[model samples]
Target: MKLQAVLFDLDGVIMDTAEFHYIAWKRLAEELGIAIDREFNENLKGISRMESLDTILRHGGKADDYSAEEKRDMAERKNSHYVSLLDRLKPADVYPGIRELLLALREAGIPAVVASASKNAPQILRALELSELFRFVVPPDSVPRGKPAPDLFLRGAEEVGAAPEFCIGIEDAQSGITAIKAAGMTAVGIGSEAMLKAVGADVVLPDTRRLSLEFLRGLLSA
Candidate 1:
């Protein structure tokens, strides 16, 4: 199979915005008198904002405490905090091998697209100054569902005019790996190998630093 396009998950795959997200969420949880730890934050990865909020509320046993409008307000508040943190980001914040891999893909005439669940994806790309490297950043609202569902990845391949079988999807979350597999694309996972493998990732790398154009091509060839 030929590699037609590469679909990327933004937060952990391209950079480390996951920590910013954790900080924001932790702040929100504290405001609600709920406690959350890093291990719990892992469950929030690769999910929508509303979904993450819901998960947090459930965890705190306060799911029924907020009205729908109150929940929206809380989510907005968290996003505001997250966006504020993003101002600290710069082009150099991109992970070790990501920039080089993206450039290599460009040189090889391969297209890349962001398939993140984050509504702030475009802003994040702009912060990293890597907006031009990707053909499109799939809008979160455009898809009916987020990670752990195939909608986003499927739409990403469609946007790039690539069939799912001919695409490679890279993600740092198990939910995202599941989405890639569900979309019928090869999954290149970043982060814990066992966790990603359990979710059916085709190949698991420890971090973005290990990603390379040659490694990607090898996946397709194999």
Candidate 2:
């Protein structure tokens, strides 16, 4: 039961960028004559940029029939909007107790990493000044597929030099949990306990409210 490392999901677990996703995507969707809400934005969580565009376009009633030029045009537009919204990105966006958790894990000699599907993850980590917090940034593009298939998380665990059973994964979406489990790791869900349980998380914490050094150490040690 010796935990060797931790793998974290970016948007929901470490930072609250899901709201930014919703806002930017909603704006883009409207311009394209599609309607979506915050709830609908949830469907795009943990997916790659290309997959995200495809999903949104499909939901709006088009298939992979999009021309290469059209795909690039739409993706660039969305990235432009999404990047601009980050002008307001602040340290406050990081969840409470996350820094504490990282420091504790570091003190315990446990490696930590970001297993994210975002192309913007490196920029976000640098902007937050938390780039050095993780042993490596396992980008989505490196893997053949992203979450729910476990490719990214499995790679992340390798980066941390930990076996799946000795690592704990933190995520906010059902797809994330599925990915972690598929990788043979423990999945800890954040955001909503009930919703995460419904998604089959091994453990669900309401938020970072109760997360602490001792609590995590206790779990990992157990």
Task: Mark the 10 consecutive residues where model 2 has the least summed lDDT.
Answer: 211-220
Model 2 lDDT tens row, 1-222: 888878889888888888778788888788888889877787898887777788888998976567978988888888888998877777767788887788887777888889988888888887777787778888777889888899998898887688988778899988899898889887888878787888678889888767665775567676
Number of clashing pairs, model 1?
Answer: 0
Clashing pairs in model 2?
Answer: none
Q: State the TM-score for model 2.
A: 0.93
> Number of clashing residue pairs in every model?
0, 0
Best by TM-score: 1
Output the lDDT of residue 77, model 1: 99
Q: In candidate 1, what are the lDDT values of residues 11-80, reduced to their tens digit?
A: 8899999889999999999999999999999999999999999999999999899999999999999999
Superposed Cα deviation of residue 79, candidate 2 (Å): 1.0
